[model samples]
Target: MRKYLFIFKAELMSALQYVANILLHMITYFIVIIIFFYLWNYIYDDPTQLINGYSKTQMIWYVIITEIIWNIVSGRKLCRRICDDVKSGNIAYNMNKPYNYIGYILSSHLGEGIIKSLIYITFGIILGRVFLGAFPTLNVLSIVLVILSLILAVVIDTLFIIFIGLFSLYIEDANPLFWLYSKLILILGTMFPIEFFPEVIQKITTVSPIYVICYGPAKLFVDFNLNNALNIIAFQFIYLAVAFGLCGVLYAKGVKKLNVNGG
Candidate 1:
């Protein structure tokens, strides 16, 4: 645990050296938020109209929160790194390391993303204030719940990515799988709320990564129902356990296969 902390700290410190990159990412996020704000504004011609139980402000903020999660999780490229390691025979070396490779990957990825997520969140709040004139209608407790949910969401997302990356140990590449995953999240989770889709699609999404990874935290933030928050958080824990278990099984099998093949 201590060693992983040191690795995490090292990664965080190293990421600080690339502040310019993250700032560019911030600019991109801000531009996307601005576009969504205008689109929602145009759609809500009548102020009192609620589309799918979300006012224009709530809708835009939902996009903001979802985009933050999407960007933070997507930018890590965990699967690509794993693919590259396998291609370069580096996974063999990594397997022999003193630290758990998955732990190292998760810790370093979190360290890399934390600062960027913070910057994006700060700017996103400022944008919300400027354009929407207020934050989500929430007290400190609700905000805390949203924050906790977001943290768990990030973990679930990272675990999924790691699971996808581990596929490189079996196949030649995993980028295509990640590409499909990203598109699913983008369309089903980030671009709009699940309620915007057909009822059947909504039901499918609830059982998918779309529910826990992007929609759960964003929904809790923009809508803030205590019952919903508790339910989402519980589901997140279940998904986390499932994701971790699947990753462990796949990785163990992959390692065994690698050893047998003497790769």
Candidate 2:
């Protein structure tokens, strides 16, 4: 446990060195929300009018929260790192390490995400307020709930991306897989709330990772609801367990295969 904490601290320090890069990404993020602001404004002639149960303010805030979550997790980069590890035979070096690979990755990502989360989340709130007014209902309880949900969401997202990256052992490439996964989440819930979709699709997404990953925290932050908060957090925990289990199983199998093949 202490060793993992060391890894986390090391990564946190390393990430601090890249603060400038993160801020550069924030610039792009600002541009994105601006576009969304204008687009949503045009879609709704009345700012107060609700579409899919979200006023313009709520919708834009939801997107901002989602984008913040996406940028913090940065699943694509993690996936590529894992793929590179496998391709370069670097994973074999870790086989002799005392720490579990999955735990190491999770801890490292959490550390890396901490700084970005602070920056992006802070920027996201200001952007929402400046462009779309403040979050309709901001309270201490709501803030706590949203923070918890976001933590679970990012952990679950990192584990799942690790799972996908582990597939590099079997597939010739995993980037395409990550691309599809990211796109599906974006289309289903990140860019637009599930309510905007047809009932059938909404039901599917509500049960999918997007429910907890992209939609859960954003929804809770946008509109505070105790019932929804409990449900999303509960689902996030379940998904977290599932994702971690999958990574462990895949990592173990991939290692066994490599050993058998005389790597």
Please give the CA lDDT of all the candidate structures: 0.87, 0.88
Backbone clashes for every candidate come to 0, 0
**Candidate 2 global CA lDDT score:** 0.88
lDDT of 1 by residue, 119-228 (tens): 88888888888888878789999999999999899889998999988888888888899898888988899989999999999999999978998899999988899999
Q: Over all chains combined, what TM-score does candidate 2 have?
A: 0.96
Q: Candidate 2's residue-wise lDDT over 77-138, tens digit each?
A: 99998888777778777767999988888899889999999999889888877776565676
Q: Name the Cα RMSD for model 2.
A: 1.7
Candidates' TM-scores?
0.94, 0.96
